[model samples]
Target: MTSRSHSLRDAIEEQIAVGELRPGQHLDETELATRFGVSRTPIREALIQLASMGLVVIRPRRGAVVAEIAPQQLVEMFEVMAELEAMCGRLAARRMFTEEHAQLQAAHDACREAREAVDSDEYYYRNEAFHEQIYAGSHNAFLAEQARNLHRRLRPYRRLQLRVRDRVATSFSEHQEIVDAIVAGDGERTAALLRDHIMIQGQRFADLIASLAHLSNKAA
Candidate 1:
């Protein structure tokens, strides 16, 4: 992808993160083209990139819209995330201890810095890196790639959640828990904890999305 395409993709993703874009809403090519001071060609390419990331859907004649994440789909994503994290933990249990454990530790420390700075986006980014270590630690490149993609698609929603009161402390504690499990080579604890971690995301998505809709109606 060209720099232009990547910039456009990041723009949309940022819009989603800040709730400037909503689900089930079409992205007008002309509008985006005008906003970005680009032609329709790059706008089309950008939408395709977003589509590949599962952040939007471009249908024949129907046009492109921000993807509507259904409750069922969130649950399914959690299920897949759990399985992926479990695979990482199970493999890391056998194949990891020194190198990978250090990587996870470094990420946790970075998260700690972000926590101290009270930077929500940075914390979210570091949290992802902390998990990425475990996925890569599993020594399974394919699994790591898949988990990273899913995690990317979920980034915007996760950022919104980090603003919840005391969320940074909560997440910090969870990271420490996972690091401890990995250090101990306890696959059961790692897997179960990771599974619960992802399930909480699904539940939070459902609750927050519902509340957001209600607030929109009340304000209108």
Candidate 2:
């Protein structure tokens, strides 16, 4: 896609992630075109890309809107995502090359800077890169692809969770331990840490739901 399309996609994705655009809110292409001072073609392209990422839904008669996933279904997706990430960590611990290890460390360092800045949005993007390094280190193409696909689907919810109080700091701390485990070639430990890092349960789940409800209320 063109740079304009990518820019529009990221802008809309951020709005949805931060709850500025609530679930099921209509995403009219014409309005988006006017709002962004772009042509409808770019707006439509951006919406289509977002739809592929599970952040938007395109309907036959209704055009497009923000995707609305049921709470229970969201939980289920997180559960699977956690497992996929854990597996990636496990394999990465044993399989990563020396160069891959260095790259992972660099990604983690970037995340640390984001955390120190206390910018949740920056940290979220850095954190994604850190996890993706592990996925690449897994040395299993199919597994890596599956993890990436699910990760994209869960992007909005995952990004939303980081906005919770001190979540970015906590996430960085977790990443520290995860990196240590993988570097030490402790597959099981890495797996466990990754699972805990990605899993949304207990209070984390509650925080996510409350945030979503707040956004829905605001939209209403």
Candidate 3:
């Protein structure tokens, strides 16, 4: 995340955000270098970092391509994300300290500010902070690390859904439910709600994919 790498990342993420570098599209270093007004070194490094976040795949023969996120992968990730977050909530309920609880409250306040501003993207980022706060509050270093890795992997999809059909407001509501459960130390409710919140996205994605498959078959 140095100055140069940050610039490259911004350029790359812009392409992704605008749908220029779409799913399964190859990332040509020469073309990317030309686009970002830099050489191959920074582009390569940026691609590697993005790949680590599950955004791209760097292969030998074809180089990097935007990762093809399958419906099954989405469903699988939703399952894993639910379990990890639930684990965090359960542990946090049992182990959260005063300072950690205060941090969690601060993060929720950030989410509230984003909601008031009606900035969904900002809401999404701050929502991540809120979840990370709970994870760290769990006091299980290993579980926190695992949840973080999964969270990063799901970032792109999560952001995409945030812009879909008033999902931002819906997400805020879910966060409120989670916070209540955490404060009450209601482990069972926390786990179930987290699972439902995550699995709902998977169900939506499945329906979307199903419609696409039908349309493709009809066109064929």
Cα lDDT tens digits, model 2, 70-145, are 9999999999999999999999999998899999999999999998898998998899999999999999999999
Please give the lDDT score at residue 58 for candidate 1. Answer: 97
What residue pairs are clashing in model 2?
A: none
Q: Which runs of model 3 end up more than 4 angstroms from their true locations?
A: 1-20, 35-37, 201-203, 206-220
Colliding residue pairs in candidate 1: none
Which is superior by TM-score, 2 or 3?
2
Give candidate 2's total backbone clashes: 0
The local distance difference test score of each candidate is 0.80, 0.91, 0.78
Q: CA lDDT of 187 in candidate 3?
A: 80
Q: TM-score for each prediction?
A: 0.84, 0.89, 0.81
| Ten-residue stretch with the least lDDT total in model 2 | 14-23
Give the alpha carbon lDDT tens digit for every residue of 1-220 in model 3: 5679777876686566444566677889999889778889988889888887777899988799987777777778878998998888888877787777778888988999998899977898798899888889888999999998887666666666666666778888888888888888888788778777777354568554554454346545
Alpha carbon deviation, residue 112, candidate 2 (Å): 1.5
Specify the poorest-scoring 10-residue window by lDDT in model 3.
211-220
Give stretches of model 2 more than 4 Å off.
1-11
Which candidate, 1 or 3, has the higher TM-score? Answer: 1
